[model samples]
Target: MDQTVSTVIDEDVCIGCGMCVKVCPVGTISMKEGRAAVTGKWSLNCGHCEAVCPVDAVRVMSLDKEQSAFGTFDADHRWLPHGEYDTVQLVRLMSSRRSCRNFKDEPVDRPLLEDLVKIGVTAPSGTNSQRWSFTILPTRHAVIGLAEKVGGFYLRLNRLAEKSWLRFLLRMVGKRDLEDYYHTYYEYVEEGLMEWKQKGRDRLFHGAHAAIVLGSKPGATLPKEDALLAAQNMLLAAHAMGLGTCLIGMAVEAMKRDRSIARFLGIPDKEQTFAIIALGLPDEEYQSTAGRKLVVPRYFEG
Candidate 1:
């Protein structure tokens, strides 16, 4: 973790109220001679001090200000305090964001995709590593190109699963992955592949005009979780932007099982992909929010 302090406090603007010192997670800022100063050697560069400052005197050089600026919409730069947002509308948006399988033939603009990536990075990361990477397939042609690669991978996998002797041999060595995949997904994948090849139907991406592949570079403390959190942000933001989104887990699995797929997508060897989001203008609509299965909450008194 690169924790070298990039925080600088303007003495003239700082009121020395000690809020920055109080909120510094790594103790990077401390009150010295009645004025807050950057006395620590290391910091998380999370901009907590900057956000908490009453006088806007603190600045985190490692953080990018342009990330908050959006091209598609005007963003409110002022921070919203806790419990200030409308919870009903928030829940409504969450409930309305379903996995869309039907997308229009229209293509998504590059600026919207770029703005979505910006929304993604707003998610919290472990230790503020912020190592997440986004690879955008901005056009239908690019999306189809990646989909073909994923479909090919599944085609090869189906072939291996078709070999009963190979499945048994792998199971004999205490590896049941092949057998389990054969039992669980063989038939479904076979149908999808058939639809893709014979009918030219896109079962992989569901005819989405654009896609975003989310990944994390090496050395992230919690890469998968970080990527997933960012993915959820993108999903919700996409829905709000009048676009439909679906998570293509099969594509993620393909990249995980076959490194060549990632290489084909121009991702580096060390970077690990966590999610693939297929998105475009929706061709389908619903009347109401769907219901979820009920679950009981548990309390941990300890």
Candidate 2:
């Protein structure tokens, strides 16, 4: 197999301060001949060797300097110390964050959605491999169109799921839960499809003004976890910014089953859809935060 990553060291510029050796999580770097060298046994290409090199002697060859953003921030004022905001303020924000199903008819600007994406990507990823991408459906019509396509697919799915043979097949495939859930959904929508598509209510997206889909590389090490982490970051960021958002797993499942829907959403053919968040201005108000019971955990004390 071809080597996906490699690291380089500049012996001439090396101070041999051992920062790279100390910071390497895998212990691949060691001091040899008063210079840092990698053992290559446990190297994950995580770039701690490159980051801790005070004199820039260590280089992670897999990193693309042209494509990467470095020295892009004004560090003096932009970087903050630990006690920036109190715990009470953070708790209030966390308590206020909720899944918003209803939204106003007003349109959200593309720039604001862009800001959410910017913050979302700041989330940490495995091996610093930032393999997340965001697609913003900024218009109400675009969102509704995509929802309609997904809804139509679901309607057909509901029909097929009701058949006895299909249900038996699903049970054989260990999808009894899915089979039962679809059966329940079929009964719910059996009344009238037109009535389900009311003026202000969208069954899939709940009339949100905009939608954001978080995608991951097709073969990433932790695609689903990374994408959902980024999604949560974006969701909380949206809430903090006075915007309402909802995480919709149905959108991801729908896009995965239909290539046409994925293509229409501009998802890369080689990428997988992991998360979708509906974004919009709030149409309703919440008087208080809903309380929840904490799950009890078994302790393993030494």
Candidate 3:
């Protein structure tokens, strides 16, 4: 992790309120001679100091201002204070955003796709190591290209799963992943692959016009969790933008097993792909939000 301090404080404009110093996680900013100053040699570059400053006297040089500028919608640069947003509307959006399998043939605009990536990076990352990466297949043709590679992987996997001897040998070595996959997903995958190859049906992406592959470069504290969090942000944002999205776990699984799929998508060898989002104008609609499964909360009393 590069901890180089990128925080610059305009001393003349600073009110010396110490808000930036108080909010900085790495204590990079401190009050010196009744004014806020960059006193530390290192920083997380998380922009806490810049965000908390009273008079906009602080700026993190490493952070890009263009990232917050959305092409599809006007973004409010002012930060919403705690407890300011409506929770009811927030929860409504959360519950209403369903996994859409049916999508229209109309392709998503490149600007909208770019805006989605911008929305994706707004998610918090572990230790401020914002190593999340996005690879956009901006057209149906591009999406189909990736789908074909992923389909090939599943086809080969089905052949191996057909071999009882290999499955048994793997299970004997305490590796039950193949055996579990064979039992749980073999039949479904076989049917889907056949439909795809013979009838030109798309069971993988469900005919999505576009896709965004989310991943993380090496050295993040929690790469997978960070990528998933960013994925959730993009999913919800897509829903609000009049688009539907689905998490293609099978594509992610295929990529994990075969590195060539990632390479085909132009993702580097060092990065790990975590989520692939299939998105486009939805063809389906629901009347209302549905309830989830019951759950009991467990409190740990120490």
Candidate 4:
């Protein structure tokens, strides 16, 4: 394998800003004229320079590896074995799976919904243990009802424990920053409550025509893994079928605290909803990923 790889910076958006050069803790970046250049043959793969740069001008192209590591989609989702998938296409599909908080007030096709679930059923579980179950909220009414119930559960827990000291201590996380962490989701939810109930575009369920609630065995070694895989599969399948899906993280966070949620979702007492996917036919089409903060590695070697 090649010891060093090269990451290129897009000169256009670079703005000749040395943010990348300055932030490179490993001294792996250098200034080239007015542009930022990657140094050391990418011997240091840390991407702090690229991440800190205001303009998205950095590209971390891995050497001796697929150049599409930073982008590209696996259409067939063969990122794993035992499944014939297009690894590149899957990456695109997964990355494109956006958190759609606003959705069209429409219903989903039943057969297509069934097909999506079938795709999830094929996801590998822990040690091949299929301890996963799914509940589909088929109608708009039901989706709202479930979300409302889950939201109530969240507010109650929000008042519970005084505050999370560990997360705060480790990362200087404040309470407000801790709660409603996902892009004004709580505010959106609160505002959408009335509109969703009236079948308006509150998009409380992110405009999902249907939602698949995932359940797993408590204390099961692979519960979270199995549930997440199933959710991913479902999201991709929904995307492939010309539909959209969003994994509702807050729902899972709330459900983990409420033991009765499983029962509410028709899951057996032994099962818990580890994930919930909001699915629906897309109202509009979009390409390209919204700007996202680069995922920076903690440190580097060589």
All candidates: TM-score: 0.98, 0.77, 0.98, 0.56
Which candidate, 1 or 2, has the higher lDDT? 1
Q: Estimate the Cα RMSD of every predicted model relative to the unseen true structure.
A: 0.9, 4.2, 1.0, 16.7
Q: What tens digits encode model 3's per-residue C-alpha lDDT throughout 1-302?
A: 77799999999999889899889888999999999999899999999888887798999999999989999889988889899999999999999999998999999998999999999999999998998989999999999999999999988999999999999999899999889999999999999989988998999999999999999998889999999999999999999999999999999999999999999989999999999999999999999999999999999999
Poorest stretch of ten by lDDT in candidate 3: 47-56
lDDT scores in order: 0.94, 0.78, 0.93, 0.67
lDDT of 1: 0.94
lDDT of 1 at 35: 89
Candidate 3 ranges beyond 4 A from true positions: none
User: Which regions of candidate 2 fall more than 4 Å away from where they truly are?
Assistant: 1-17, 27-85, 164-178, 189-192, 196-200
lDDT of 1 at 1: 64
Over 164-200, each residue of candidate 4 has an lDDT whose tens digit, in order, gives: 5633553454445544343344445555554655655
lDDT of 2 by residue, 1-302 (tens): 12244778888899999999998876778899888887656566677788778898988877665433323222232435488868898887888899998899899877678778777876777765678878889999988878887887777777786788878887998889657766577766544345555643476787898999898875567878889888988888788777899988776777888878888877779888888899999887889888879988899998
Model 4 is weakest, by summed lDDT over 10 consecutive residues, at: 63-72
| lDDT (10s digit) by residue, model 1, range 1-302 | 67889999999998889999888888999998888999999999999999999999999999888889999999987889899999999999999999999999999988999999999999999998998999999999999999889989998999999999999999999999999999999999999989988998998899999999999998789999999999999999999999999999999999999999999989999999999999999999999999999988999999
Ranking by TM-score: 1, 3, 2, 4
Model 3 clashing residue pairs (backbone) = none
Best candidate (score: lDDT):
1
Residue 48, candidate 2: C-alpha displacement in angstroms: 4.6
Backbone clash numbers for all candidates listed: 0, 0, 0, 16
Give candidate 4 regions above 4 Å deviation.
1-88, 155-203, 218-220, 296-302
Better of 2 and 4 by TM-score: 2
